[model samples]
Target: MDIFVVDDERIIAETLAIILRNHGYSAETFFSAEHALASIGKSPRLLLTDFRMGRMSGIDLAMEAHSRIDCSVILFSSDLQECDREWQMLQKRDSRCTLLRKPLHPARLLQQVRLSLSTEPRLGLHVS
Candidate 1:
């Protein structure tokens, strides 16, 4: 499955992509939401994005991407409390949306990706 990693910080996005690639997944990296959105064709199997971006937030990216294709989104944020309301609202609208706190452990991120892309549909919110 294809995965897209979007982050304003180039290093973060690239590093994540490399990690996913090393794990045998086809992954791509984008430094901005606009770049990723413009490049998205059929939508990837998963989108791993940073919640707080300059022009477009991860939530915005997720919303737009969801409108175009059926895919799962995993949003990473440093301040989870600040986005709690928005996250809950997103969950109500899209059961496939999930939130992972920043400073993520590589193993946890991989686990979440697996769960999000699993054949068995996962319901409700996932915060880690």
Candidate 2:
């Protein structure tokens, strides 16, 4: 698969996955970080997830996924300002990940996905 779209909100995850699929990319939806992690037998190229979720934070999942597989991560939050601590930890620990502040613009999301699929990974907090 090309990507795994995870969010605590099932509808959001499903919708994102569908959008990516409609754009000719392979994608899957997971309602929680744990479920995404559990299903990563053969990790997809990218993991797009929500920053806050039950039981596990997105950073924790990203770290764990990076440890187990070679995939990039994109974490989204309604307010990036409130997630400074988590964001800092993630930035210090990894460069193949990005934080996208919510109300994501579909075009920007697709652009980032394309850029992420390139030979190199990009690291900048994208607020689209």
Candidate 3:
């Protein structure tokens, strides 16, 4: 299963990708939503994106990608309260969407990833 990590901060995206890769998962990093969208054909099993970004927000990217593919989306934001409305709207649209706060703990991130994958069989992902 492939995991795509998107963050405007290059280090964050790359580090997340490396961590996922180290854990026996195939992963890639994208510094921009546009670039990630362009590569949607890769059909990532999961999307780990920063909620606030230049030009496009993570919710927007997830919505567009979910429209095209059946994948689980995990959005991270430093300011969670600011995106409450957006989160509610996304949940109404797709229950598969999940939120995680920024400055993520490695263990929590991995747990969420596994939980998301296990819970959403439509994503066609096998954890083991």
Q: Scored by CA lDDT, what does every candidate get? A: 0.88, 0.86, 0.86
Report the C-alpha lDDT of model 3 over 51-106, residue by residue, as the tens digit: 89999999999999999998998999888888888888888888777888778889
Number of colliding residue pairs in each model: 0, 0, 0
Q: Write the per-residue lDDT of candidate 2 for residues 46-92, one digit (tens) a residue.
A: 99999999998888899899889998888888988888787888888
Q: What TM-score should be assigned to candidate 2?
A: 0.94
Q: List TM-score per model, in order.
A: 0.94, 0.94, 0.91
Sorted on TM-score, highest at the top, how do the candidates line up? Answer: 1, 2, 3
How many clashing residue pairs are found in candidate 2? 0
Error of 1 at 128 (Å): 3.8
Compared with the true structure, model 1 gives a TM-score of: 0.94
Query: For each candidate, C-alpha RMSD in Å?
Result: 1.2, 1.2, 4.5
Q: What ranges in model 1 sit over 4 Å off?
A: none
